[model samples]
Target: MSFKGEHHPGVQTPTAESAGFRFNHTMLRVKDPETSLAFYTRVFGMVVLRRLDFEEMQFSLYFLARLGEGDAVPDETGERTVWTFSQTGLLELTHNWSTEDQPDFAYHDGNAEPQGFGHICFSVPDLEAAEAWFDENGVEFVKRSDQGKMKDVAFVKDVDGYWIEVVQADRMA
Candidate 1:
């Protein structure tokens, strides 16, 4: 996506930094998996991929991705649902259930306010389209700034109050 920082057009894209290592998956801790699942599914348009349920502990596990036909569903289990999809990239959603054998623990500490996790980011084919969406949704954003020339940083918060950073940097290249 086209990213314009407070200063100028952001550097290159993130993929350029890593040799081949792309972003993998991001996990969040939810008070209720069902409620959280709903947020990702209904709001963000993600589908469940894999999930485990522990009826004994009253907990469930869920995995979700952006919806796309190219994606494949995993083997089914009685415990929970399996969902997968793709946008420009991938979005994975997980729901974990706790049983007598396992107790619940927070996966991440949302301490940085929105800046902590920042936010789970996805790629967009059109930066202007993305900006328009943000504008229509009343999403707030920080303009980008340049430390030198090849590095830029800015912040935006997600619905959950976690910071999502918009970054653009060109390795010494």
Candidate 2:
């Protein structure tokens, strides 16, 4: 089947053909799996929905998701892979084992001089409570909600220096 498409300059509407798509997962390359996993699971309450380790490739992939209340993660790989692909919001952490020994190694956080990728954001119910929890757990904040001119918006850095924006779901501008 062949179809032709035309571009409408001023049209700002979605066509029916594009309505069925859903945003899947975002992947972040992490230097250390232990610290990154701990920061995400412990701080954000995300669970490892699936994990794929390539021993020969010297790397591993960890799929994490914040499963809703009463939702259970499947123990079997077949069921888990299906479940992982069915969700819209998911975080994938890729761990390169070789980075474990490189203490001074770092990833481009995107907020540097030549910024390209911005950051990943999480919407929480309560901004204040989340901020306090992050502070208590020693999570480094790139921009606190109350610091900048933009209120109720904050950014925190992960173990790999990747920025993760934290905002109140009901209070976002």
Candidate 3:
């Protein structure tokens, strides 16, 4: 299948060197790790696959993923680290020390002027149920499924104001 619009000249078929390449994770800098972690884990039901701390650098990295049924995390640290890196659709939250203590500290959410990075998305089984769950959890909504012209897509904001797009893929079809 081809796209409707004119294609880029630089676009080419995948090469053997890129055969095994996969999107690993997208990193977002957060002001507070605890708040961001709680929102991601408790609200989104994502599991913390691995965490790394650079004491000398005064920063920490938290890797999270939504695992499927019967998926098991490795008991060994090295194995778990390897396993964490191998998974797709992971979210990495980076926290620099002492940022949380500063009341004025903020991260650019890329929704304002000169917008660039937009949002991360999650596909749900039921859009209505997910919207209800987000409402119950007191999540800040950017747009609801029934609110906009786009009927089946919703957007919610995290603790640090990063947008998360929610959609029911089956309904979209």
Which predicted model would earn the best TM-score?
Answer: 3
All candidates' lDDT scores? 0.50, 0.89, 0.92
Error of 3 at 103 (Å): 0.7
lDDT of 2 by residue, 27-73 (tens): 98988899999999999999988889899998999999988988876
Rank the candidate models, highest TM-score first.
Answer: 3, 2, 1
Q: How many residue pairs of model 2 clash at the backbone?
A: 0
Name the better of 1 and 2 by lDDT. Answer: 2
Off by over 4 Å in 3: 1-10
* Cα misplacement distance, residue 123 of candidate 3 (Å): 0.8
- Candidate 3: count of backbone clashes, pairs at least 3 residues apart or interchain: 0
RMSD per prediction, one decimal? 10.1, 4.9, 2.7
Arrange candidates, best lDDT first.
Answer: 3, 2, 1
What would the per-residue lDDT of candidate 3 be over residues 134-169, giving only the tens digit for each residue?
A: 999999999999897988899999999999999999
Model 1 Cα displacement at 161 (Å)? 1.9
Q: What is the lDDT of residue 41 in candidate 2?
A: 97
The residue pairs that clash in candidate 2, if any, are none
